[model samples]
Target: MRFYGQQRLFELTTSELERYREKTRELDYCAERPEKRLLAEECREMVTELEQRKNRMLASAIRRRQREEIEHALDEAEIDAEEIIRELEGESA
Candidate 1:
């Protein structure tokens, strides 16, 4: 099979991203060691892609469950935005 956009959807949740991010945070990015530095660079790139939704997963040719998850995430973000706005307004007033 062929994908036009060619970006493989890895089907990841936000929690999965968080886990990877946390795991990477614990790693020692030792500048003295080439391998460690390379690892750090690669991990940073991967996490950046994941956060940008450009990773090999969670994408446009999405399955039903993935679509639902995206919708739910947007809904939760909307609620969080509203709460933040309310808090800021309360603080100002």
Candidate 2:
């Protein structure tokens, strides 16, 4: 379902974040201070964005499951109502 796609995206984002962190650490040890700072800032922004995306995906998954459950409950209610009507009609005959 949609969860599967989101799960893949989550995994890819996590991997990318890890790579960016590693790159930042490597840059820290080198001579180019300005480049390192810029990269570090970019990495931080990416981290924030990815975190937000992950939260959204989690929320979506929860909402989807809840919707499915509600639909199932409604279907069961309708079936029960139909059975009750049938029983009432039979008794009247």
Candidate 3:
């Protein structure tokens, strides 16, 4: 797909871009050594798994940050007594 903007660019999501970079790096590494095909495959699989885990962890971190910001804002606002009490209770518990 064509990514329309100021510069000509290939359309790729963040994950796709990461994977593409990883695949290219792996290809370059594998090309240097011709005899270790099995090891190369295993390493490539490990890299893929690691990248997937990294993405998942990053997403979780972003969500946690957003939740913290929302909680902070709620704490800052002066709401009804019931709401304030609920917030205090939630905090203590």
Q: What's the TM-score of every candidate structure? A: 0.37, 0.78, 0.48
> Residue 76 of candidate 1: its Cα lDDT?
100
The C-alpha stretches of model 1 lying farther than 4 A from their native spots are 1-11, 29-31, 54-93
After superposing all C-alphas onto the true structure, candidate 2 shows an RMSD in angstroms of 2.4
- State the weakest 10-residue window (summed lDDT) of model 2: 23-32
> Clash totals for all models, in order?
3, 0, 0
lDDT of 1 by residue, 9-84 (tens): 3334456567666656655545467776677677777788677774334444456467778999999999999999
Q: Each prediction's Cα lDDT score?
A: 0.65, 0.79, 0.61
lDDT of each residue in 26-86, candidate 2, tens digit only: 7666626787778777776877787787678778788998999999999999999999999
Superposition error at 58 for model 2 (Å)? 1.0
Give the Å shift of residue 68 in candidate 1. 14
Task: Tell me the lDDT of candidate 2.
Answer: 0.79
Q: Return whichever of 2 and 3 wins on TM-score.
A: 2
List candidate 2 segments past 4 Å from native: 1-3, 24-32
